[model samples]
Target: MQWIECRVHTTHAAHELIAQLFITHGANGTVLEDSRGKDFTPEPWTDIIGKPKTEHLPTDGVVVKAYFPDDGTLEATLSAVKKDLVQLEVTTNQPVAQTEILLTTVHEEDWAEAWKAYYKPVQVSETMSIVPTWESYEKRREDEHVITMDPGMAFGTGTHETTLLCLQALEHIVNDGDTVIDVGTGSGILSIAAAKLGAKAVHAVDLDPLAVQVAKENSEANNVSERITIEQRDLLSESSNEQKADIVVANLLAHLVIALAPDIHRHLKVGGKLVVSGIIKQKEQEVIDVLKQENFQIDDVLEQKDWVAIRCRLTEVGGE
Candidate 1:
């Protein structure tokens, strides 16, 4: 399918708001690129040696991409993105002289095949290996572990930086017989990982109904269906449960993570760790600050590429 690359350039202050606005309005597969990073930092999050669950992913400037039909609607979307645009260009139809955007077409099969080239077996720490569903590996290859995952449009394929950071954090913190909950458990990777790690019980919650079904199937495929239960729960809302967990792991958007910080802390036992991810580097501090108000002690930070994952532990003091 051909894609019209609508380029919208804005300051770092407006990046998140504009990108989110466009995607919410109707833009699909929005890819954000950092044109001029003013509030950027130098050192990478996983630069420290001996950090667990650290993956050596490419270090690229802030860029988010989304896919959508090339139509006039892009103009409206771009306008909604920001009032100030140093450069605004759209690539559509036959290349016009006035348009600065690059017009490129991609066949659906070709794009899929291209991504397949990067699909390789990933050793998630020493105990777990994340293998693509379509790929094969010899199990008898001495202590090799495998978690087969095929990310079908739903995130958390164990390939992204945030997921790997979380998985690495899990390896360090998760203990046997601990009651664990994976908020936004996509493809049941985190939930299944917890089960495989010997957690006494696991609850995988997702707001999307389809994700619930997908997670259930994945859990069954990994033979952890009995241990991990997939349920629909909106963490943003207050809900009463007969049980709270010893650990809560949420790999969600940075804003949602901040908004749900209080509830996340409430649902955890004292000193329980909350592993949070799916945050871009630019927004990591915002999430950390919000959690701090709820008496969460910032424990560890993991960064891969431009993404970040944080581990926060509930302190004896409840909240501010």
Candidate 2:
């Protein structure tokens, strides 16, 4: 099988939108490349650290690459994707600076394994590490947790700041025997991490069938299939009594998070934690406002590389 790889260069603000456009137009998966390194400075830490130093990484643009099967419809799909992206810029009135699109053909086998060259083990938190299936990583500590994943055509490998922020929040909140619901559990990384952290049951849900399949395979690879259940479902839309959870973590777009705030709050047990990520710094307050309206109280906030993750809890009232 052959695949057409489409790479789009655009501003960081437009990266997520562009990726969504590709997925909507039939791309299986997307990869983001931003030369800017992540800098996480919790609000409380700023006083102690005297303001963390920021790196002078590239700020010009980011590159987003996606793959589509080289079927006869490839051209049409790419054209549609481009059109959607252009419309997005027009709708937002913000230019996708340095916009460029490049296409290349790659064999299935080659494309499948090409990412491995750059997908080495990544330590997202103090005790959690993401290890690609093809890589060898030695644990440096006794209590470290390793999540083995291939990602394949799924959406996460724990390298993105959004994912890292969620993982960091999960590390502090997930307790033994607690039930966890991972909305949009791409690559099943969060589900696996929760299981490793002693969650008795982890339900991972995604709307994409390919993501569900890859997440299931990753859970099995990490020996957490028994604890983590991967399913194809929208965000808590069909949640029932059986789906109520102690911790609900969602690493999704800011707009989606805001839209699902009420549903997310409804699915959580009273006083349960809600960890949300994939929000840009500019949109952080918008999401927070929605969460507040949904009766959730902000507990903690994590920021990295202009992305923000928030940890909030369902309160009995507004104070509890």
Candidate 3:
């Protein structure tokens, strides 16, 4: 099968939003390349094949490449994606570095395993690490927790800064025997990590069916399927009034996080913590304002690159 690869040239600040735009327009997966040289770290024993020369790396911006089926709607989807990118730039008051969209044809056989070369074991936090199923990573310590996952087409593989920040927060927040609610649990990474951290039960929910399915598979692969309940539901929509959790983690877009603030507060116990990510540094204040309005007390703020993750607690009275 042939696929249409749409590459967007943008800065690190705008890469996440641009990739999300592509995903919303029917792209299955996205590969991000930045000039920071972070993605070029290769394993020692692995032989380099078809690796790009240092000069080929972009020096000024990031390239986000997303794959879509070569169907008749490819052009329309690309047009919509580009329009959304432009609108995003205008709304955020930040340019995308380059407005031109690059297109290429990729054969299924050639592109299937190409991305695996870039996915190595990532140590996201002190106690947690994300290991791709195909990668061999020796545990560095006795207390280290390794989460084995293959993201497939879903998100949250622990590579993105948002995911890393969320994982780091979870490392400290998820207590043993506590109940955890993971909103938009892509690839079930957070849910699995929660379970591995000794959470009594984990409820993982996502609006996208593909994400729910991928999360289920990943949970099983990580041996946490029995502890996690994966469902295709919007954030806190299907949650019952009695279904309060000890911890609620949401690694969703900033706008979605703001919209779900009230529901998140409702679904958590009186003093439950809410760990939220996927927030750009520029829009961090907007999200913080909404969270405060919803009576969530800000606890700790974790920032990586241009992204920010907030760990807040739902106040008992939920007000001033």
Candidate 4:
């Protein structure tokens, strides 16, 4: 089996976003190379393939390398990726340091196992940790909430700055017997955490079919499938006449957050909590402004690295 490696050179700020773009185009795995990677701590594959070369990484930028199966859609996928990268730059005002999308052909064994080294037991908050299915982790504390995850082709590890921020915000807001809605629920990590935190029921929705499937599997793996319903739906569309939720969580980009803000009140009960994450540093204020316009009262603001998550409460129902 062969694979086409799409290597993108971009600023550290855009590295994660670019990797996400590749995933949206069907890249099964991604490896982000940057100065911060020194702490990756490779183990199993290190002895087999030797330590990954870190010294040769671009001095001024991060390299996001993604692997797509060379099973005949390379031309179309590559074109789509390029087009999206351009739109991303315009949509979010994200600076693209390099435009050349470098491609390299390699064997399946080259990356199939290497990327697993990237995921480890990451304690997203004081009470919760994301442990990959391929890893062995004992509870740090008796009450520690362990979420078993294997994102597969869906492309989230629950450890990115945006995800970490959302996890923390959920910890502060989710309550027992509360109904929750998670929009753009990649890998269903947030939904699972909400269930563990006592949310009576969770409706997790994502537009990506792969994400929907992966999330359902993760939910079942964490033993919270009974409480969480995973489905593929676009939250950007009109909301259905379903039961209002006590809380809503969206770990999506800033533009989507802005576009989805007005409709959020529909899914949430009056004064219900809203946990929003995945906003890049540059667009934080833009998202805040949008939320405020929709009658959301900022309850808390969480920031880490270049990402921010806002916890808000629906002040009052504007209308039905």
Candidate 5:
């Protein structure tokens, strides 16, 4: 019951990518910290304004921590992580900024219990507040939506900007009895959010089997399993039961968003909405150009730190 906490200190250039790399190597929990100190405002995202801010926070870069097994594969896993970090530049076609990696040994219970100390309820939007499964939260507003989740080994806890933006967008657009298809539905956060926001049925898909299972579990925990269908599949794959949806959400890397652009109409009804996130601000224009070519009209854009989540609508069912 021990783990190695791998901390990567790097600029905003590829912070999320580095954290995702840790998850790919079987890391259990990921914590990303970027000191936006004096500018910290949880407004619209959280109601805890009196919350104390950390002192001496790093101003030079972001610190991303993830838990990996201290088992015999440490050397091999660490080596592979390093190699992947090096190739990030080629992967994103953007130069990887300077980075520093730190390691520490921690008992499983110590870090697992750490969530209570740091992870608090976040009001992702005017209607939704993401509460940890263990925390007992009383709604501050009658119309607020509360989503309780454990995340397990999957991502999207609503703490990340990409997920928060998507949750917020869903609050404004998802109508009662609407059908939603969530691509790259990690941890089933978006699917769960869409269901909670009144979507009648949801199709959540992920290439990672673990993500698929965790998402299914999350849907059940949220009491929305009856409304969600979890599957292990790639993006936009043709399924015998495939049906068009009123909304499609893909919180994946920017490059993947570009690749998904051309085929989006196949699964989305005309005038259906597409919510895309996990995009760094630098790649915003690149993604938008691709979507435009496919006849998508931008509707709204939300930003947090170096990340952005965009909501666009399809003007035509088929490509331009």
Candidate 6:
């Protein structure tokens, strides 16, 4: 397969928004470039501090990808692209024609191999590790641990700062035998980890069916399939009053997290814990404000590479 790379340089705040917009209008996958945040290193972390999780990722810039079904006119896509740009320029390898969009041919091998050099195994916490299928972990002199994952069709592999922060937060808040609901569970990593860490019951939900299927496969791969339940439900539009959980973890975009604040509150048992992540640093206040209105008290806030995760506890009825 061949791909056409479309890159846009803009302010950090507009990075993901722009990429998402492209995908919404029919782009395959968007990549965001880290322009202002701390550069992510490839070193493994065996020991990590636990803190609150954030709802959206704070990014300075981003890159997005979109797949073209066939040779088509670039006018529509280009026009759609222009809607998100302010002081940016667009360039194409092929000349823009009237009828079809002819993207310059890019070999899939070229793009796939480039990411290989940047991929490596990472330990998100003392007990959890993130290992990509393409690489092998080096034998350490110490008794370091590892968590093997293929990444597959999901967006998270536990290598991103946001994911690492979430895992650390999970390590701190998830108690053995507690029920956990991981919203937007990608790759089933968080849900599987929770089960491995001793959560008695786990329900993982996502809006995407493929994500649900992928998470299920990952659970089975990690041998936690029987312990975790994967479901396809759009938390934003679905009614969740019938369900309640001891812990609810939603690692999602900031806007979506805010939208689900009331639902998240409704599904939590009294005094239950809430873990929120995938938040960009700048949007932390927006999410915190939304959750606070539902009577959730912030227990801790974790920050890593400009990403934040908030750990909150639901207060008792008629109590603070």
* Winner by TM-score: 2
lDDT (Cα atoms) of all candidates against the true structure:
0.66, 0.80, 0.80, 0.79, 0.80, 0.67
Q: Per-residue CA lDDT of candidate 2, range 165-233, in tens?
A: 888899999899999999988788889899999999998888888888888888889988998877788
Which pairs clash in model 4? Answer: none
**Roughly what TM-score does model 1 have, to 2 decimal places?**
0.68
lDDT computed for candidate 1? 0.66
**Model 5 TM-score (2 dp):** 0.87
Please, what are the lDDT tens digits per residue for candidate 6 over residues 210-306? 6788788878877878889888887634634256888888887789888888767668898999988878998999889988887889999998767
Q: Roughly what TM-score does model 6 have, to 2 decimal places?
A: 0.76
Which residue pairs come into collision in candidate 5?
none
Give candidate 4 regions above 4 Å deviation: 1-3, 13-31, 37-59, 80-99, 104-112, 236-241, 318-320
- Model 3, range 239-308, lDDT digits (tens) per residue? 5425789999999889999988977756888888999998989889999999999888999999877789
Q: Model 2 reaches what TM-score against the true structure?
A: 0.89
Per-residue lDDT, model 5, residue 292, is 86
Tell me how far the alpha carbon of residue 78 in candidate 4 is from the true structure, in angstroms, after superposition.
2.5
* Residue 267 miss distance in model 3 (angstroms): 0.9
Considering TM-score, where higher is better, how would the candidates rank from best to worst? 2, 5, 3, 4, 6, 1
Cα lDDT tens digits, model 1, 155-246, are 33465556777888888888989989888776789888888777888888876565788788888877888988778877625334447788
lDDT, candidate 5, 162-189, per-residue tens: 8878888888899999999999887898
Q: How accurate locally is residue 224 in candidate 3, as Cα lDDT from 0 to 100?
A: 81
Count of clashes in candidate 4? 0
Q: What does each candidate score in C-alpha RMSD? A: 7.7, 4.8, 4.2, 5.3, 3.0, 7.2
Selected candidate, larger lDDT, 1 vs 5: 5
After superposing all C-alphas onto the true structure, candidate 3 shows an RMSD in angstroms of 4.2
